[model samples]
Each structure stands twice: as structure tokens, then as C-alpha cells.
Target: MKVSSMDESGKYDKANERLAQVKEEVGKVMVGQEDVIEQVLISILCDGNILLESNPGMGKTKMISTISKVLGLEFSRIQNTPDLMPSDITGTHIVDESADTTDFVFQKGPIFANMILADEINRATPKTQSALLEAMQEKQVTVGNNSYSLDDPFFLMATQNPIEQEGTYPLPEAQRDRFMMKVELDYPSLEEENKIVDRFTSELDFEPELENVISRSSLIRLQEFTRKVPIANDLREKAVNIASATREKEELDYGASPRASMNIVLASKARALIEGRNHVSEKDIKEVAKPVLRHRIGLSFQAEKQGMNEDKIIDQIIEQQ
Candidate 1:
């Protein structure tokens, strides 16, 4: 069913209500970082994973919890530690001779949920990190020759401490590329922080209750709509060119993968839906360029020494359009 043909007024009302519902749900637990929450939701609704890089004490955990609650999805959080093992996240097969002598039962891990918050992902070793990354890419975990697919609306929101370097394992380029967006969650404004303080201190330390306005099936439908959303030939080329500039441009050593193009296209569709548009526009592409493309592009040591940043390179590509 077309977005336009399916009860236009009703769909719009529902969409808007869902948007507001998510915002209100997140706002209840979080004092601010509304934009971060919105972007994270966009990624989730688009069936994509997100990488949120911020310092400590940024309420990343609370935000993920609130979103899971509002969406009525099973939520799981894994505190990624250096000593974390693959079996710890992907589960393992242990023969329980005491309970059942003949059968080996599968012990499920935290990745089995619909919504997963990989808190402090950088703290985990790369081997353990790949366990979650594989699930993010395949949406399934394999153990002892058996595979288990994760539930639908399976979303991973990983948080990292950008400032902390001690005993942290930063995500490599290949792993980073899997994420649809690398969102930066900064400190809230002074007014927002003050409100956070007042609310947390005054309230019972519990977030507001959120109504489940959207369903997992409806979310899947929305993702399908995003795939069907029309993109003009020119806009498609623009997206391609923007991706090409990342690798071919002189400032960078490596370019973004085909995954980046996919992200740009899907994220633009999600943006249009949020803005009540049936078709995607270049404006939507431009809006998502930075967050979608920043981490995908790699800078040379010379460029880094020269203080050239990803945003600057993306700005140049945007100016070309």
C-alpha cells in the first residue's frame, strides 16, 4: 500500500503521533539530547544500527532503555569489557549432564533481544566485539552448529567513550562501516542540564510512562516504504558522487563503502517520512551526509597532522552539489 493511498490523513496523524510518542518517551527519561534520540530512532526505524560516541555520564543507557520501553520491545544491555568473551555475548553450548544427560542446551546471551545497548563497546576486545558485529550484520547467532535468528526490529545502539583512551579498544574501520550513523552526543545546553537536575532530584528517579503507539510489524512496513520511496535520478547520482568523493578526494586515504550509499538512501527516506513527505529530496540527502559519511571516510596521517576533519571533507562535497 502506498503511503499516499493508505488513508492519507490517518497515516499522517499516526506518523506524527508516533514521532511525538517517541520524543515524549525519550524526553521523560532523558533531560536533553533530543536530536540524538531522534537520529537513533531514525536508525532503528530504518532497520539500521547506530554508533553513539560521547563522554561518560551522558545518559546513553537511560535513552536506550526509554526507547525500548516506548517501543514495547525486549531490551538488553551488554557492558563491553576487555575481558568479555564471545560466548558471553553469543552464548555457548554446555552439556548439562546433571539436568539432561543426553541433550546439550543453548544458553542465550544478551544479543537475543530486539533492542540492544552495547554500552562502552570500545572497552571490549576486538574478538568479543566481532561477536556482536556479526549479529548486527547477520541478525543471527551461530552456536554449536545451530543458528538462532534474532527477533524483528532488532536494533543495536552502541555507546563509546571518545575521550577515554586507557584500556579501550577502538572500533576498527571495517566494524565501524557496518553502523548506519555515528552520532555524537554532546552535553546538553545549560537550561536543559538545569532541568535535568531539577527533574531527577524532584522526581522519584523514574521515567514517565510511554504509550506503545507503533508495532514491530508497522515498523517493518515503514522500512519497506523507505525502500520504495522514489528518489530522482539526479539525487541518486548526487548520493553516489558524495560517496565517491570520500575515496577519490585528495584529502582522504580511503573512501566509504557501498554501505554508505545504502545508508544515505535509507536515511533520506526516513527523513522524508518524518517531514511528512512521500518522496525523498536532495535536502534529505544533505541532511544525512555528515553523520552517515563521517566515519566511513578515512583521513591520511598528513591530513590528520594538518588538522583536516571529516566534516570539512563532507562540507566540500556538499558545496559541490
Candidate 2:
């Protein structure tokens, strides 16, 4: 889909302006992982949740922290542990002695921040894992008997360690579907690594000031624009076909849910806006297919025993479709 440079509505120009500012801010601290950054932006712009899988020391936390700083938002980090409780994440109520009565006042946890970094999410127990579902889906946190809406432009960037499978309670299917994308961060190039080491070991821990270019109102406008991005009938049908193939294919056990199709289309639209286009394209759909659908689809026992990863299965589905 080739969009004209001059959009009649002029909305494309606004999206591009904000995108440029975000990219410029992200560039200050992050060395590589451009695709990862783009995917994260897609989720944020679409008001969707993200689940990031990466080996330790890949700077997943740093990337999210940079995003928060650039946006001039409050950032919070939570380290998920096996013994962590739901209250630890969602916060519990406390009694006020001055009031002389017990009122369920929500204290709010790390999840209440504008930008939250959930480090080692899978390490937390399933009970604790369920605590995030409401916040991620409804943009609100419920503690005790009261609910509190999170800040505007709320984003959850959760990281999970893939190397450690033991003693980890994998996120259930229902909870996993709430995430918009599951991005995998890989090792940086030798040159990038060299730069990182030199910059970090030196006394000059370079921290760049990310200018606040987009305001709360502008972000809401961009999200509305994302919804208005055109998705042709044929492209929408193609997205469904690709999702269905994952379930019907001989190599796979289960297929992606209806939510997968919804996320793909929405994410594709966001990607188009990020690229300065007003309409979604097949290329955008294909680019985000794996991350959006990988966790949503279940694998067969044989496929799992054979060590077939979700990425490989997603590739086959996209190719066949």
C-alpha cells in the first residue's frame, strides 16, 4: 500500500512528527535492536501490552527506562520472584489511624506508573501473574474492593528469561493473550558491545536528555489515528487466513484465537502510522505476525518434543498463507 506523501486529512504529518521525536529519544541510549524498538512502539501507540523475551544483559530494562525518560513519564520496575504475591504487584489497602476507621485505600504498586518494567515476569507464580491481567487489559488496577485507573499513556513492558525453564511457572494462555506482542531481544554486534562497555566503565555515564515532544493529548490523537488507518477488505481476510492456518496446519496442534486476528490488524495499522503511512500493508502484517501470534498459538506435543520453536511455526504459517 503506497500512501501519498500529502495526506488529504493531514493526520499522517502529525503521526510522523511524533514518531520522529520518539525515535530520536530512543536512539540516545539504545545501540541496536531497531526492530525490537519499533515493535515496542507499535504496542504503545496501539494501547496494547508487550511481553519481551531476552537473555540477561541485553538491556531490556534499560530500553524501557529510556522510553519512560524520553516521554517524561513516571517509570517503575518490578522484579518478579517465586514468592511474590499479588498484593506486592497490585498493592493493598492500609488503615489510617487519624481517620479512626479502616478504609480500603488503594496504595498502588509499581504497576501504577505510566511506564512499568516487569523484570523476569515468568519467575513469579501463576497467582501473582494473574494480578497483571486486569491492569494490562483494562488500564486499571483493582485492590481489595476498589479499582484505580492508571495514568494516561500507561504501558507494560514485561521481560522474561527464556534460559531458565525450571522453577518457573509459565504464563497461562488466557493471560498471555492479553499481550499485543512478544519481542525477542538478541545480542548486539561486536562494535555495539564495544561501545557499550567503554561508555559504561568510564566515569562519564552518558545520560542524554530526551526532549518531551509529544504531550498527553497528542498521544491520544495518535492512537485515534491508528484506529482510523485503512485496512482493506482483502488484507483483513488474509490476516484471518494466516491465523487460521496456524491451527489447521499439520505441524501445529492449536491455532491462534480471534484476539490474535484483532491484534494483528491493530498492530499493522500502528506500524503503518509509524512508517509515515496512513494505510496498512501486507508487509506490515508479515513483519509483526510472529510476535503477535507466537504465544497465542499452542504447539503440539510432537512439535514441542522435536524442539520446534514458535518462530519456526509462525514462519511456516506466513509462508503458506
Candidate 3:
């Protein structure tokens, strides 16, 4: 495809405008935590999954559900639990009594949707959690003896509550690494909270209605455009350097893999497009570095004894680099 300057600019402008509409629509339902919204948008644009960590009653589910509405994607929610079986999520074969001959028919599960919200994902056992591995990475679900392909532009949004750890299984490192970004949603600001209160308790009934800002096909095209956004050669190395530096730090037991670097650049490009820019910048890389790498690296026991966290370790790496 020969993309001319004008053609590229027009497509980018349309996408930029559409994204602003999406933000506006989501904001009607959600109050504060704009960063969380932005990071989720970037991850979606990059065709990756997001791991959202927060306390209860943060509207994590409400926010993502609203996002799916505006994107015009089929959305499904999975409330993970200890007893939730892999078959429950991926579907299974059922007896086909209607058929002339006795046979079993494969039934599609919630994993077949365009966007899936895995609520309280940590509540599921590792065995059950692993069910999402193939679907998330390869956009395919295997059930019975058959492999089923998921919809195009498949995206997963998973949430976990950090305050409650009991009866919760930690996400395996392999699954953690599959998420492109780990978004943290904090409490609403005072003014934002007041607005939230007013909206819910208004004398006039108020319901947030989100229209589809862009069609599903348009979103896929935007994703292609996001990938085509130019990145400077130097910025690429800096992105890799940020991830590689974590490995050299003796205080950290394990560092991020090369996948971290790839996500950083991909996220940076998405951020640039959101900001109405045609090319990626070093600043874009730095802005997305924290979320892209925070969950990928492991802290040493010594560092844990010293009360060091992943964000702090990531901060040090970015500062020195």
C-alpha cells in the first residue's frame, strides 16, 4: 500500500477526532483517572491486553463496559473464581440430539467476543487462568479437539484487587507478561467525586448514553495506521535500553524480557497518534515506559525487605538511562 502524506494525514486526523469522541463518551460515565482511560486506549490501539489493578468500587467494570459500547465491539464479562473451570470459559462440545446421526457439536463460549472483561481475574486458579493464554496471545481458543479462531481486533481487559489477597492466586509470570500494560486506577478527586454524587442522585434522572464513535472496521483500520506511525531509530534503541537496564540492576532478581521493549515502542506510537502527532518521540517512549514495564520485572527479596516496589525500580532505571 503506497500511503501518501496527505492520505496518511487524513486518516490520522479522522482517528484522532474519533478518539477524542471516545474519551468524551467514556468521561460521561466515568469521572477521574484520565491516565487509566488513556493507557487502555493505547493498549487497544496496539492490539494488546490490559491488566487493571485497583480496589473495589472503582467502576473498573463500568468503565470498560462503556468503552466497549463506543467501540461497537461485542463485549463479554467473565467473573473468575476458584471453581471456574476452563471448559466454562472456552465452551465445550454438547450432544447434538437434533442431528440425524448422533454427534457432538462445539459450542462457543464468552471467549469468542471482540472484547472480554475478565473481572477479578486473580480469583481464578492458575489452571483456569491458563485457559486464556492461547486466546489472549494468538486470538484462538482450543476446546475439545478443535481450535476456534476469535474475532479480529480481539482485546482483553482484566481487573484485580490489590487490597484483598486471600483466596486469590497471583497471575503467573507468563500470563503477566502477556499484558501490554498494567493500569492503576486511583480514587476520584474531590470535585470529581462530587460530580459522581450529583450524577447518581440527580432530581432529573441521568443515564450516560455512549454512541458508537467509530465502527469496528474503522477501529481495525486505525490499528493499522497506528503501526505505520514512524519511529526514529534512536528512540527504538532507547526503548530497548530501558528494558535491558533493568536486567543489569543487581537489586532485581528478574528483569523484563525483550517483549517489554516491543510494547514500549508500540504504546509510544499509539500515544503519539492520540496526541495528534504523525511520528513517535522520545518523550512518548518515556511516558509509556512505566506502565509497559512495571509488571514485567521482578523485585529481589533483598529489595522487598527494603520495601522496594516495581515502580520504584522502574523509576531508577528510567532516571539512570
Highest TM-score among the candidates is held by which one? 3
Q: State the lDDT at 58 in candidate 1.
A: 84
lDDT of each: 0.84, 0.85, 0.91
lDDT of 2 by residue, 249-294 (tens): 6667777888899889999999998898878999999998999998
lDDT of 3 at 275: 89
Which prediction has more favorable lDDT, 2 or 3? 3
Clashing pairs in 3: none
Q: List, residue by residue over 1-321, the lDDT tens digit for candidate 3.
A: 456878878877988899999999999888887889999999999999999999888889988998999999999999998899999899999999896898988988888899999999999999999999999899999886789999998999999989356788999999999999998888998999999888778857666667999899989988998999999999899999999998998888889999999999999999999988989988899899989998898888899899999888888888887
The TM-score values for the models, in the order shown, are 0.93, 0.93, 0.96
The worst-scoring run of ten residues by lDDT in candidate 1 lies at 8-17
Please identify model 2 stretches exceeding 4 Å from their true place. Answer: 1-9, 99-104, 163-166
By the lDDT metric, which is better: model 1 or model 2? 2
Q: Predicted candidate 1: what Cα RMSD to the true structure? A: 2.2
Better of 1 and 2 by TM-score: 1
- How displaced is residue 245 in candidate 1, in Å? 0.9
